[model samples]
Target: MWTAIAGGIQYIIDMGASVMLPIFVAILSIIVGVKPGKAIRSGLILGVGFVGLSLIVNLMNDQLGPAAEAMSQRFGLSLSIVDIGWPGMSPITWASELAIIAIPLAIAINVVMLLTKLTRVVNIDIWNIWHMAFTGVMAYAVTGNIWIGVLGTAVHAVIAYKLGDLMAPMMVDYYELDGLTVPHGTSSYLAPVAAVVDFIIDKIPGLNKIDFNADTLQEKVGVLGEPVVIGFILGAAIGFLGGYAPDQALPLGINMSAVMVLMPKVVKCIMDGLMPLSERAKKIMNEKFSGESFYIGMDPAILLGDSQVVTAGLIFIPITLLIAVLVPGNRVLPFADLATIGFFIAGAVAVHKGNLFRTLISGILIMTLTIWIANQTVDWVTAIGVTTGSIQAGSVIAALDQGGCPISYVFTQLFTMQNVTGLVVIGVLYAICMVFYVNLSKKRAAALEAEDDEE
Candidate 1:
């Protein structure tokens, strides 16, 4: 019976986030007093939106994957480690024994945190619980102990919730996303880095004066600066650079243009489904908890619709490839996950106040670190792949983002006792960043409060 229950969960997860998120949302909506018919419709609409978003994203992957490959060949860049990306890493994580319990454990932790006022985020992005599971499994794999894995997962959940709380103001103020925060491991982990980078940029005299963002571009360049137009131009540029014929490049440009145009509409549908429940939840929380505020933790993909983020991400593709070739000891080619550049930079955009120039600079630094981390973790990533049978016994494997995640790298290193001193240094730096971030958040909150008073 236990095996069957675990298998059942694995089956639901295997159905993918587009299916699973909606089912969970529908159940939650009904529990929150939404009518059954409306709840079902909302859930189905959310699913449709997710499906639409996935389709456009897949189109991007299909087009960009080959271009990145061709670029890699043209540049004579070769690495021994195969960059299988997140698709490969996620399977290995799901296959772990820890995955069976990761969901319930994370959910329970979230509930306890909320009840105790330890967190204000109600995390609904269940699909990303795999990140916690991945960390747990890595600990188990290294220590040969299940309890350590469980503890690691619990700790990871706590960190994610706290990060979500810290970042909520930025999400609301800069991204204009109210009542939602992203707690996904990859995106949330960058918040501290972005905050630090933004702080440094502010201190630089000339660098701080260059004010460029999506709205600024649109205002200065007219129609040419529109995201769809930008996407078309960028897609064509990449295709041409990859040696595609004009005929071939035109379709790729159109596909990218479609993505820019369609992604926002898809996000709108998701927000439509979510807003009602969000309002209801906010009202209930405020009434029950004496006006306490809460945020719903969500996937970060919704931020990809921002024009500046898409533009910066597209520009970073070739930049990342170049960095991979030039950076010593880097063995990942950044394929499969190249399409994820937009999501990676979304937080940076918010942090930099949508300034494309600042975001690009920060993105370069972030990717440089990510590539180095990916290179450093190749052995352990490969081991996990082998243990889960995701890779052939003698095959090499690596992931551009997941493998390079600083949190994952530090935790795995610390738990494995591979490099205790390095972990200690990283922990110190991370703690300092968190302190800075907390102070910044408090100031921003005060400013918002002052503005509210004036209004």
Candidate 2:
């Protein structure tokens, strides 16, 4: 019976996020009081949006991934281990035994937290549960204990939901994404570092006044300030730097410009599907709990449609590679993940209020730290890759997304004790960042409440 059940769940996951997410969403919507017809329509729309997003992301990876590799080669950045990135890493995660139980485990944890008032986030982005599963898989790899791995998965899920709560105010204010929060993936986990950086910058005199966002550039430069134009320029520039001829470079520019334009339209489709459900959820929650509010946790991809995020992602493609070279003894070259670097810093951009200048500062730190962690975890990631046949027996692969995740790294290290010094340093720094992050969120929530009162 258990084998049959596990096989059934694995089958559904194997269908990929574009299909799995919609089916889950449609069912969840009906459970949450949406009409059946509307629920089905909503699910289909969300699926279409995800399919559109996948196509755009694939276009980005197909075009930009090679350009990044070429640029790395041109510069003799002899980073040996390849970062297969989330697209590759996610499949390896699903192939694990831990994955079959992770979805249900994470959902159960969310329910327990919600019932106990420990968290206010309802994470319906079931596809992203893989991130939590990846954590468990890493712990299992380190200790060879399945139960310990399950604990790691549960701990990660708990932190993820709380992260959703911590960033909700900023998401509402900056992205204008009301009642929606991102609890999924690297975006939320690495965001605390930005909060810490933002706090220090706030204390600095001249730095505190720096506000160079996408809108500011648009206002100053007229036509050239537009996101599409900026995307074209950055794309072509990266291609040229990568040693591409004018013909290929110019087409890369056009493709990036298309991404800048099409991202929001497809994201709007996702929002169209989400809003009815979000609104209904809010209504139900308020009525049941007497004015209490909650957030629907979602994927960070939704945050990437903003012009600031799109422009920042383009700028970081080359910047991330440079950082990879600078990090001491770093072996993982920033490839597959470079195409969508925005996911790494979308929360930072929101926390910094769309200030590109601040995002650049924090983004550098984020990538540098991610690379350092990715370097440490290459063996474990590579092992998992091999076990799942995602890679050959001896192939060394890493991913910056979950491979470099702090929670995963810290948790696994606690059990292994293989790198005690690393554990101490990262554990302490991440703890400090969390403190600042929580304080920042509280202040933002208070400010928003005050504005509501004023209205």
Candidate 3:
């Protein structure tokens, strides 16, 4: 009886402030009417929140004896803290957190909003569905071996972005409050167009700085051309059988990172090193500089409504091919790069909805965003003292891997000396591309600006 009593007492405490959740929701709901952010508790945001909390608290408790499980309990709330794909809680982790926050917040806010005549519940997200979706796709595509987490991010972002919009009757989400008036769940369908924008931006480095107007996303998708035609055939053949970097039939450990992501960056970097003249990309020995773009792309907001999936796919293929060749033997048949292949295939089939330049300029955007995201990832890892080496021992820790990616199960088998060998090989290849790309980009930029001026 005494034991039962203690157990029950612990349960009560573990429930923590959940009992007061309604009151908390009520208070927040009242305040959210006046403050926008106070009303939005999304999954993407939670992904960062959970992971950050887990890391800090786990570190606070010295790694929490193999993944912390009681951090939320301290608050009398049941929290299942774990490693997200990145440094924070992932979709699953955020799901648990969102359940705790969203429902209560919804009830509180909904009740208040209804009473105050603030809204009628039509949408959920405040804005930027395209940004959420594009980032989701990009992150998922580049996650390499951690595909499940990538998918989870996709699902969570989509759901969280429109949670209130879809379940308006029950949720005090954006739709219910009428505060969210962006797009709905159709963002994924438009991913192909977004993909096109990404590819275009990447091709022409700084071009993205001046052109975020992706209004032609749909129109870009509509044009069924060689790039998309070939890309679709190739992507369909690839399917979802392989991941970002699958181990090849050979004994060699293929460091897909080297070829898949790093190789291209290296080549581009080398080209950057050799490029002729760009005020920012190149400087004559010692020169003052400002990070501002030569121009800013139109707001991405205007572009999202008009884009489609086909154009995004067309842009996806060739770029995918570049990375594909670098990592060819690892899982070559194209089935391995489903996200990328899917992108190309879908993009080819999509219809262009706006202008040609919108599609053309996407490549530059991809390059810029990739650089920012890569740097941010590095900064996050550095902050936690966890580097590629710390986690690269090729030993599988089930606890460390939330999802069951086969390669993840055998770390050493996957991350062996092969990583070192592949890096060396690709490093040489990237150096070559770098030299070429840098010069081409510079000349192209000058010519394009002149052309634009003439137009």
Candidate 4:
């Protein structure tokens, strides 16, 4: 029975988020007092939106990937280790023996935390449970203990939920994502570092006065400053740089423009499904738990719709490659994950309150750290791939996202007894930032309450 259940879940996960999220949302919606018909419609709409979003993403990747590869070749940016990116890393994580058990374990942890009021986030980004599993897989690889791997997975899930809860207000306020929080592996982990960086920027004299953002850009350049226009120009520039003539570049430009225009509409579909459930959850929590508030944790992909995030991500594309060339000892040329630069900077965008300039600076620092960490973790990442049969025994493999994740690197280093001093310093800095975060959350909550009272 247990084996069958695991197999069933694995099957659903294999179907991808577009299918799985809708089913979960529909069932959860019905359970939370939404009418069955409405619940089903909501689910279908959400699913369709995700499908549309996936198509656009694929379109963007198709247009951009070759261009990026061509640019890498044009620039002679060669690194010894092959950066296989998340596509190569995710499969190895799922194939681990710990993965099957991680799903239930993470879910149970979320439920327990919710019941105990240890966390206000009900993390429903079930598809990303692989991230938690990845930590465990790495731990198991090093320690050769199945239980330790399981423990690490649970710990990672708990930390992710807490981080989501702590950052929920900023996400809602800055991104206009009412009642939604991101608990995905990559974005959630960035909150601490982004907060710390933003704090320092706040203290800096000249930097603190800059108020540039999407609205400002739109105001300055009129329609030409629009995200779609920016996307077209950027796409065309990349295509031309990759040696495409006018014929090829125009279509690529149009494709990127379409993605910029359509992505927000797709996100609206998800919000339409989620808002009603969020309202219902809020009412129930208020009545039962004496006005306690909660957030629905979802995938960070929805955050990419913001023009600021996309622009910052696009800016970082060339910057990342430049860093690869300029930074000594850097051995990873970012390829497959080049398109995912948005995820890397999404947290920083929120931290800077959507300030494009500050976010770009923070992104550069974060990406530099990422490249260094990826270089350091190449051997372990390659080993995991080999063990899971994702890569051949002698083949080289490296992950830009997972290996570059500062949180993952810190945790792995700390627990594995490598780089003790560096991890300890990070831990201390994170603790200080957490103190600031808690205070900020409280002030925001209080202000919201006052505004509600006045209304």
Identify the candidate with maximal lDDT.
Answer: 2
What are the TM-scores, per candidate, against the unseen true structure?
0.96, 0.99, 0.26, 0.93
Best by TM-score: 2
Clashes (backbone N, CA, C under 3 Å), per candidate, total 0, 0, 63, 0
| Weakest lDDT window of 10 consecutive positions for candidate 3 | 293-302
> For residue 433, what is the lDDT in candidate 4?
66
Candidate 4 ranges with C-alpha deviation above 4 Å: 418-443
Q: Please, what are the lDDT tens digits per residue for candidate 2 over residues 287-331?
A: 887788899999898998899999999999999999999999998
Residues forming the 10-long window of minimal summed lDDT in candidate 2: 382-391
How well is each residue in 1-455 modelled by candidate 1, as lDDT tens digits?
98899998899899988899889889888888888898888889888888988887889889988987777787788865657766668778888878779999999999999999999999988888988787787777777788988987888888889888887888877888877888776667776777787788889999878888767888899999888898899888888888889998888888888888888888888877776677777788778888989999988877877778778888988998988887787777788778778877787788777888888787887787778778877777777777777777777777876677777778778777777875787677777777877777677667777988999
lDDT by candidate, in order shown: 0.81, 0.92, 0.28, 0.79
Residues 324-433, candidate 4, lDDT per residue (tens digit)?
A: 77768878878777877888888888877889888877787777767877886777687787777777888877777777765566666766777677577656766676
For candidate 3, lDDT tens digit of each residue in 353-429? 22334543333333222222222233222222222223333322111111211111112212223345433443443
Candidate 4's TM-score reads 0.93
How well does model 3 score by local distance difference test? 0.28
